[model samples]
Target: MRKPAFHRADERRFLDERGSSGPLAPNGLNPATIMEKAVRERIVDSYFYKEQCFGVNEADIVDRVVEHVDFIGGVTGTVQKPTPFLCLAFKLLQLAPGDDVVDEYLRHGGDRFKYLRALAVFYVRLTRPDRDVYARLEPFLEDRRKLRRKGKSGTSLTYMDEFVDDLLTKDRVCSTSLWKMRRRDILEDLEILEPRVSPLGTLEDLLEEEEEEEAMQNGDDANGQGHDGDSDSVRSVSRSRSETRPRSRSKSRSRSGSERERSNHDRMDVDEPGTQRSRGGRSP
Candidate 1:
């Protein structure tokens, strides 16, 4: 048996075909392919250079770490797990913590996702003093905006206030007590924390309840209309019967008047015959 010879056309066909595994072009690069490659290289270089800077005692690495951290922070909405990357960047800048970096993050951090802010809070907690952490992160508890998160089932929205509350009260962005590792232990050994509730799920439940109430109200209105129709039919039937009773009474009165006139005529005829017989007998 002879093996088939690989050709450039075959490689191009393979790259052009879209499937579960991503697109790849060997001979000619599409714009999409080029952009994807560029993004991949940037990510790889960002991590590699940061790691390389970590190995050496370099002071200029702070700028590179900060730039990468800011980039990751800005992309928190798209990236599923940004904390690991952020923690790595924080570790790289551990020796010489820049006040400008912290200030810049604090100023622009509100525009990022809440999880990103939580990760930033974790970084601050680890690096800054306790007083500075309180001073910087406490005001975020008042944020009213929601954070969207993707899960196994679907996407869910949550309040930033709740996340900030957890950070402030528990000294952690998320409750560790509810972790799978903690749950795997004996029930008695486990300290259960309040489960994080998604605002989106709650809103959905409320909307369902509202729809049910509206359906019930509509059913009641339909029943009310049916009852009103029944009442109207009954009233019309009663009115027709009342009108018929008056016509029957008038007919009865007319028949009684005719009977009285006939009796008066018969009495007059009998009196006239009696008077004539009496006059003839007296003359004879």
Candidate 2:
């Protein structure tokens, strides 16, 4: 398979430690060579220097370093090892701080490009404080795009999230209080620093009060219905009694009229004296 563009470009100037023909420094590696004439001339003519009034510009310095690494037969020459041009550029920027240069680099630095992003990260880490570092770099941890890294025998893919993790923890990219601390220690510190009070507590209390009020209103409705039922039952009983009272009075009047008619018939029988005398003569 073909290597990625970045990996191919990165290896273009890598120098192999063994079988190298040159005067060795104390580090047992060949000293870096001067930049190619053409590349040097381009750097001198670049507008980056002109905009800075011939003063030192970090972006221009970084661009020169990248150009030097990419150039054929330039200082570090074409070799087969990892290059330190990025680290050198980072060091140069750190030595001379420039907000305008940093801003320009960040604005132009595409996050998809690992080298450019790495340079931006290094600039932020060296210049910004711990709090700002975490705030700024945390968002990059969510990026999951694959990046290619040259391995000993082959290339391996790594996610951007993993790269960011390495930058933050393994590489100590930012100078925070938890720098070099264990994960457990960091968690403990976070727990201690987090606020104990929650913002939802008041909302919960309000919900509970609303629920209680609903319960009370339901109970009141139930009690009101029960009272109405009792009143209805009492009215029904009184109405039945009132309806039976007129019937009882009519019955008493009919009984008194029958007794008076019986008394009048007995008086008529006593008043018939002629019939009684006729019966007495027949007996003599």
Segments of candidate 1 deviating more than 4 angstroms:
1-83, 92-100, 112-116, 128-131, 144-159, 171-284
Question: All candidates' lDDT scores?
Answer: 0.48, 0.48
lDDT for model 2, on a 0 to 1 scale?
0.48
Instruction: List model 2 lDDT by residue over 1-284, tens digit each.
Output: 99665322221122232125434322232222222224333333444322332333455555554443321111222332223333343234323445555555544553424555555555455445454455455666666666554433454567656756665676332121212323433544766322223343667788998999999999999999999999999999999999999999999998899989989988777846787888877896
Q: lDDT tens string, model 1, 1-284? A: 99887433222232244333443222222222322333323433454433543443223433444444322221133442333334343332323335565554555644554444554554454444444555566667667767654332344566667655554555323212211112212322443333334545687798999999999999999999999999999999999999999999999999999999999988877767768889878996
Off by over 4 Å in 2: 1-56, 61-85, 93-95, 111-113, 151-154, 171-284
How many residue pairs clash in model 2?
A: 3
- Each candidate: how many clashes? 0, 3
TM-scores, all candidates, are 0.33, 0.34
